[model samples]
Target: MAMRKFLINFNYLNNYKNQAVRFLTTASTLSKNSEVLNETATELVKSIVEEYENKGKMFTLPWVDQHAINSALYPFKELLNLGIQPEFLEDACLHEEKLFRSMIKNGQSIYKMLTIFVENFIMNYEDSIRMFAKWCDLLENETPQSIQSRINLFSGRGLASGIGLRRIFEKCPELLFGSEVQKMDICLEQISNFFESGDLKTIVNNTPHICLLDPTELESKYEYIYFHMGFVSEELAKSKCWMDLDLFSIIDRHSLLLKTGKYFYPDPKRPQLKKENPSPELIFDTPENKFANLVAEVEYEEWLIFRELCEQQRRLEDKQEPYEKIKPSQRKAFERRLKEKRENMEGEIE
Candidate 1:
C-alpha cells in the first residue's frame, strides 16, 4: 500500500512540472510577439516622422508627438499600400494641414475614396493623388456614392467612358467638385442645339475647360462661330482651339484677315469665289509671331502696334471715355502701309 501511494504521488508531481513548463513556454512566446509588434509599430512611426521632417515646412510643428504619430500611422500605411508615394502625402499635408488631419482621422473613408478612383476610374497612383489633393476640401464632404454619381453625370450620359472621364478630369479636375455638374449639363445642352452629339462630345473631350465658361458666353461664342464666321458644326468641332480663343481675340483676328483680303466670309451661293484662306486652326492656334509673319504676312512690329492700338481703343470704350480718332497724318501713315500690302497680295494672286 505504501509503495502504491508513493508511485501515485510521484506521477502527480511529474505531470504538474510538465504543465508548468508548457505554461512558461507559451508566456515567453506571447511576450516575444508583443515586443516584436511594438518594435514594428515604433519603426513605422519613426519612418513617418522622418518623411514629414524631410518634406514638411520649416515652420511646422514637430511630428514627434505620440498622438500625432498614432493618428498618422494606419492612414500612412494604407496610402503606401495603395502605391501612393510618400512625397505626395507630404505635399498633401503641407498644402492642407488641417484637411489632411481630418482625412487621416477617418482613414477608411479616404481609403475608399482613393480606391474608387483607382478601381473605377482606372486612375494610376499619381493621377489619383493629384485629383485627391486638388479637391480634398470638396471630397471631404463627399461620400464614395456621391463621387460615383458625379462621375456618372459625365460617363453615364454617354458623354465619356471610364477612360474618357479620366481624360476629362486630367484636363480640368475642377469638374470633379460640386455645382460643376449643373454648369456642365447646362453648357452641354446649349451646345447640343448647334452641334450633333458626336461633335459636341469631341469638343468637350478635347477641351474640357470649355465647360467652365458661363452658359451665355458659350452660346455667344457658338453663335459668332456658326453665324458670323460661317463655320459649320463639324468644322468648328474639328478646330480644337476655337473654344479656347476669347471672343474679342477671334473678332480682332478675323477682322484683320478681312481687312487684308486674306479671308472672305463663305457664301453658300458663291462658294467658287472663296479664295484659299487660313484655316480656323491656323488663324486661331498659331502664336502671335507666326500668325503675323506667316498667316498675315505682315511685319511683326506692325501687328504689335496695331494690337496695342486696338487694346487702347477697347479699354477707353469700356470705361465710357470719349473716343478720339487717330490724327489724319497718323491714319494716313498706317493706311498707306496696309494699302501697299494689299496691292502686293493682289499682285501675287494675279
Candidate 2:
C-alpha cells in the first residue's frame, strides 16, 4: 500500500523492482518489530489492489498482450501526466492506437470531456469515450460557457440527473455532435412557446432526448396535437416520449381511428389524451407485438399495413381539397340533419 502511494508521487512502475526492494525491507522491519503495524499494513495492501482492479475492469477488450501495452504507451503516459487514472485505458485503446494519435493532435476537447466525466457526473472512462466519440464534432465548436451549460443541464435536472446523460446519448447521439448550438436555441424557443415555462423541465424529465428534436418538426407535431387535437401542453409534457415517435405513425393512426368511428370529439372541444382519458398504449408508446390487440390486429405487421392504408387515404384527401372548407349554410344544414337523425334514434330507444 505504501508502494502504491509512492506511485502517485513517482513513476515506479517502469523500475518496480527497485521500489519493491525498499517496500519489502520496510515490511520486514514492521512485521518483526511491530505486530500491530503489520496487520494494518496488510489491510492497506488489500485496499490498494482493490482500487486498481476497480478501474482496470472499466473496459474489457478481447486482446491483452505486451504488444497492446506497447501501442498504448503514448496515451497511457499522456493521460498519466494529465493526472488521469491508469485504469481508465481500456484494452481497445491499447490495441487501437489511432484514438490516442488523433487525441494527441487535438487533445483539448478530449481532455475537457474527460475531466467532465471524471469529475462532474462520476462517470467511468468508458462512459466518457462513448459520449466523446459521438459528440467530438460538435464539442469542438462548444465554447466554455456552452460546455458548462451542458454539464448543468444534465446534472441539475430532476429525472435527468438521476438517469445521467447516457440514456439521452443512446436515444439521440445527434444532439451531442450533429447539430449547431444556434439550432438548439431555436428548438428551446419552440418548446417554450408551445408549453408553459416549467413544462420545459417537465418534458426533459420525461424524455431528455426530446431536446435534440428538430424545431420545425416539433412545431408541426405540437400544433397538431395541441392546437388541432386540443391536447394541452401539460398533458403532452407528461408523455413527452410521444414526440420521439415517428410523425407519420402518429398521423396515420389518428386517421385510422377517425375512419373506424372509435374517435369521437366535436370541433368546439378538441380531444386530448390526458390522465382521465381512456386510450390504448399505442398513442403513448411505439406498439410492439404485446400490443397487437390495441388496433384489433393479430400482428404488428397488420397494424403497420393498416397505417399505410390510412396514409394513402390521407394523401388522397390532401389532393382533393384546397382546404377542407365547407360553406357555412351547408355545414349548418348537415348538422341539423345529423341532430334529427340522432334524436330519431333516441326516440326509437325510448
Candidate 3:
C-alpha cells in the first residue's frame, strides 16, 4: 500500500511540473494587450508551481487537480476580481478569430463540435442564470466583471437580458460549478436586476445578441434558446434539442445559427467583435423573448386539444366513425358543436 501511494504521488508531481512549465512558457509570450489581472493570475500560478518544485513536491500536469494550483490561484475569487476589467485579456486568451482560423486552416471540426454542446445546455437549464456563473468558473479563469460585461453585451441591456448568461452556460456548462438548474436561476435573477432600473428596449435594439463561444456550440445554444423560447416552432425545438445535446454540440450549434442569417446585430461598428469593452448600444427588450414563449404555448395547446379530441372520438366510436349515422353536412355540424363543447369545457375549469 505504501509503494502504491508513492507511485500515485510521483505521477501527480510530474503532472504539476508539466503544467508549471506550460503556464510559464505561455506567460512569457503573453501579448501586451493581455489583461493585467489575468497576467497577475498567471504570475500567481507560476509562483505556486515554482514553490512546489522548490519543495520537491511532484507537479501535477494540467494543474486543475493540484491543491496548490487551486488554492494559490483560487479560481472563483481571483477570477471574480479580474472580471472587473477583463478587456485587457483580449490578446492573451485565445480569441474566436484564432479559434476559427485554427479549425479552418487545419480543416478540423473542433469548433463545430463545441457549439452543439452549448445549445443543449440552455435547454437543460430551462434558461436560468446561476447555472451560467458556475459554468464560467469551470470553463475559464474569467473575472466576474468580464462575465457580467459579456452577459450585458450578448443579452443587451434589460431586466430580461439572458443572452449572455445563456451563451456562456451553453458554451461550457461543464465548466460552471453548480447543477444546471441552480446556476440558471441565479443567472436569470442577476440579468433581471441589471435591467430593473433601465429601459430594456434600447439595450436589445442597439446591442443585439452575439455568441462569443466557438461557433458550433454558440449556434447550438442560440438555436435551442430560439426554439424553446418560441422564437422558432416546437417541431424545430425537438430537432434542435437533440442536435444541441451531442458532444461538441456547442461548437456545431453556434455555426448553424450564424449560417441562418436570422440572428444579427444592426450595429455595424462592433460587428462580430467579441471584446469585453463594447460600444454601448441601446437595444434592450422588455421581458425579452417572453412573447415567443406565449406563442409556443398556444401551439402546444392546440396540438394537445386536437389529440385529446381524437382520442375521445376514437374511444366513443369503438373504432367506427362516431358521426357515421349523421349525413355529411350534419356530421360537419355535429363535429363543430363537439369542438365548441370541448373548448367551453376546457375553458370552464382547467
Candidate 4:
C-alpha cells in the first residue's frame, strides 16, 4: 500500500509539472502578442496624426484579428527591409502574402512601380484588390519593358507621365490593348500635317495620347483651324494649345475675337488668328481658372465662349449630310472651276 501511494504521488507531481510549463508558455505567448499589438497601435496613431498633417495618407496594419499576427513575423520583417516609411509599413506587412504573390505574377519592376503608384493613396483591402486586378488586366499582352519605355518617353517629354501608368492606361486603353496600333500611326501622320515642320516627336512629347484621335476627324478639325481661321502650320505647332480641341471648337471660341476686334495673331509679322503664345501646357497643364487669368483677355474670353460654342458647333456638324472632310484634291477642283468661270466672264466681256 505504501509503494502504490508513493507511485501515485509521483504521477501527480509529473502531471502538475507539465501543466505548469504549459501555463507559462501560454502566458509568454500572450505577453508577446500584447506587446506587438500595442506597438502596432502606437504606430498607427502616429501615422494617423501624420495623415492629418498631410505628410502622406497614412496606412496602418490591421490588428483586429490578432490571429494573422501570430501566423508569422517574417512579413513584418519584410516590410522593414523594403525601407517603406512607417506610415505605410504596417499595412504592407499585413498584406505581405498578397503583395508577394502579385510580385511573382507581375515581375519585380512592374510590381515596384505599382507600389509606387499606390504609395500615395489611402486604400483598404478591397481597394488594394481592385488596384491589383487592374494591374493584372494591364499586364496581359504587354511586356514590362514596353510599359517602362513609354513611361520614360512621356516623363522625358515634360508631361504628367509619372501621374500613374495605370492612370494613363485608364484614360486611353487602346494604346496598350487595342489591336490597331497602326491606326494611331496614321493619326499621327495626319496630325503632323498641321504643324509647320510637323515635329510629331515634339508633339508626342507634349501630349502623348493625342494620336488616339481618328485621322480624318483630326484632319477636318485641322483644316477648319488653318483655312477658315487663317492659322499657319508653324504658328499652330508653336502653340499646340489647340491640339485637343474638338471639331469647330477653335472657330467657335475664336469667332468672338473676330466679332469683337480683339483677335490678333501670336506672331506679329505673319498675322493670323490669335494664339495663346504659351506652351500647349497652358490649355491642360494648369487649372482653367489659373491659366485663364494668366493669358490674354481675349484668350480667357475665348475659353469662356467655348462651352457655348461647343454645343452650337456640335449641332451644325450633326446637321451636315454624311459630314465629309474636303480633301486637297476636292479643294483644287473647286478652285479650277472658279478659274474657268472667271475666264468665261472675261471672254464674254471682250
Candidate 5:
C-alpha cells in the first residue's frame, strides 16, 4: 500500500512538470510571434498613411496603440484572406473608423463575420462591402447568441429560408441589430393568422420590410383589407403595394372608388356584382394618375383634389371635430364641386 501511494504521487508530479514546461514554451513562442505581428501592424499603418497622403485625401483612423494594432492584426489578415481588397479595407478604415475600431476592440472575428454573410447568406464580396458599416454595427451591438437567435428565427421558419432569408437580410439588414425578436415574432404570428401559408410566404418574400412594421399597425391593415374591403388573403398577397400604402390612403382611395361606382366589396350573395369591380391590383398597385385615369375613370386632378379633402377630413377627425360641424358651408361647397366634377367625368365617359 505504501509503494502504491508513492507511485501515484510520482506520476502526478511528473505530469505537472510536463505541463509547466509546455506552458513556458508556449509563452516564449507567443512572445516572439507578438513582436512580429506588432512590426507588421506598424508597417500596415504607415502604408495606409502614405497612401492617403499620396492621394491628397483626408484620412481618419481611430486612436490606435500597440494593443489596438495587435488586436486588429488577426482580423485584418482574415479580411484579406476572405477576398476583401486592401483598398476596401483602407477605405473602411478611413470612412468607418469608429466602427472598424469597435469591431476589433470587441474581439469579433472578421473571418466568421464574412463566413456568415458569404457562405450562409450567399452574399458576394461587393454586397458585403455595400453593407459593411451596417454589418459592423450589427456585430458590435449584438451578441453572438442574439444574432444566432435571429438567424434561427429566419432559418427555422418555412416562410423565410435559403433564398428567402438572403432577400430579407439584403433588404433590411437592420433587422439583425436589435432586440426585436419578440416584436418580429408577434408580427409574423399575426401575419400567419391572417394569411394562408402560401400567401404568407409570398408576402414575406416579396415585402420583407413588412417585418419592420408595428404588429398593431399590420394587424389593423389586415383587418381593414379583409373585413372592410372584403379582400381575401390571396388577393392581398398578390397586391404587393398594399402594405406600403398607409391606412388612410387605402381608405380614401377605396371610398372614392365606391363613390365613383368603380369598386365593390366582394359579396357571395351577389356574384354578378363582382364582375364589374376592379381588381385589388388595379386599385392599390397603381399610382394616383393611373388609378384615376384607368380604374376610377376620373381625371387625375379630381383624384388629387379628393386626396387633399381626405387629408383635411382626417385632421378634423383627429381634432375631435366633424367636418360637417366645423365647416358645414365649406363642406357643402366642396361636395357640390365634387358632384359637378363627377357629372362632367360621366359625360366624357358617355
Candidate 6:
C-alpha cells in the first residue's frame, strides 16, 4: 500500500497528486503537547472544510464516498459517539508519527523562513506558503542575510543594499530565530569580534572599503563623504544624497565625511594617509562592533547627565549656596543610577 499525504488545499489536490497521497496517508506525527502542530492541524481542517462546503467544489474519486468522507472527517471533529470527546483521534491525527517525521526530514528552517516571507508579503497561510515557495525559488542561489547584514539594516546604514533581513525577521519570527535581535548589541559584539580577529579578510576583499568607518557617524551626517571626496578635488561633488556609495569606496567615504565632517574622526591612531589606491583590507573584519558601542553609548550618556548635574550644582555653589562638588563616590552612584535608567528605558540589562 502507498503512503498518503493530506491534500490540505484544493489547489494541492489538483497540483500535487503524488504529494497528496503522501500527505493524507502519511498521517500527522506532531508531539501531543506541540501548540504549533495542533494549530496547524486545526487551521488545515478549517481551511479544507471552508474551501469545500463554501466554495461548492466537487472532489472526485477518493473524496466521492460520503460515508468515507464522513469517517475521514470524523477524526477532525471534536465530539464523540458517546457525547464525550474522542481524545484518542485528536492525539493520533495531529500527532501522527509519520507526518512529523516527514516534516523534520524536510528541514524546519525553510518553514520558518516561509513564515517570515508570508508576513512580509502580508499573505494568508496557504498564500504565504506559495509565496515563500516562489521566494525560495528566486533566492535559491542567493545567500541568506548574515548578522552583519542585520546590524547594517538596524543602523540604517545599508540603504542601497536592499538588505531588509532584520525587518523580515522582526515581522516573521517563524522564519528566523536568534537571541541577537533582542540584544542588538550582541550582533554588534559578534561583528566586532570578527573584525577584531580579522576573520573577515574574505568579506573585506569583496565589499566596498569604506564600510570600515564608524556606522554612527555615517548615519548621523552625509558630509563625511564630501570631506573625503575633497581628496579627489577641492570642488566637492554635489550630494546626490541618493547615491549608493557602497559601490565606490572613495565616493562613499568621501561623501560621508563631507556630510558629517565634525563627526568624522582623524583617529590619531589611524590617521589618513595619501591614497595610492587603498586595499579592501582597510575595512574592519569583525562580524560586529555592537558590544563596544553599547558600552560607549551608556558611558557617554552617563557622562552627559553627570556633567549637567555638576554644572547645575556649581552654579548654585558659585552663589555661596552650599552645593558641593560631586565626589568620585557620588559620581559612581550617579553613574549606576543613570545606567539603570537608560537600560530600563531602552534594552539589555548590561
C-alpha RMSD values across all candidates = 14.8, 11.3, 21.0, 15.7, 13.2, 20.4
Off by over 4 Å in 5: 1-46, 53-67, 80-111, 124-130, 133-144, 268-275, 304-350
| Residue 221 lDDT (model 5) | 70
lDDT of 2 by residue, 1-350 (tens): 45455344334333333345553566664454333222322333233334445657332322355454333233334455444444344333343334434344345556666666556556765666655655555565554456656545555544355245545545655555545556566677677788786777677655656777787777766655553334566666767456876666555655555444444333333334233342423455645444445643346787678877867777787755322333435665554564566457659879
**Number of clashing pairs, model 3?**
83
lDDT of 6 at 316: 70
Between candidates 5 and 6, the lDDT winner? 5
Misplaced by over 4 Å in model 1 are 1-46, 50-103, 124-146, 268-275, 304-350
Give the winner by TM-score: 2 or 4.
2
lDDT of 1 by residue, 217-294 (tens): 666677666555567787778777777777767767776777676776564455753447677778878888888889
User: What's the distance in Å from true for residue 150, model 1?
Assistant: 3.4
Q: What lDDT does model 3 reach?
A: 0.34
- Worst lDDT run of 10 residues, candidate 1, spans 319-328
lDDT of each: 0.65, 0.52, 0.34, 0.48, 0.66, 0.33
* Candidate 4: C-alpha RMSD after superposition: 15.7
After superposing all C-alphas onto the true structure, candidate 1 shows an RMSD in angstroms of 14.8
Worst window of 10 by summed lDDT in candidate 3: 277-286
User: How accurate locally is residue 155 in candidate 6, as Cα lDDT from 0 to 100?
Assistant: 40
What TM-score does model 4 achieve against the real structure? 0.42
Candidate 4 residue spans exceeding 4 A from truth: 1-99, 106-137, 140-179, 196-198, 264-350
lDDT of each residue in 175-277, candidate 3, tens digit only:
2322333343444344333232343233223222211123344344434333221222222222312222432232222222233322332222543432321
Q: In what order do the candidates fall by TM-score, top score first?
A: 5, 1, 2, 4, 6, 3
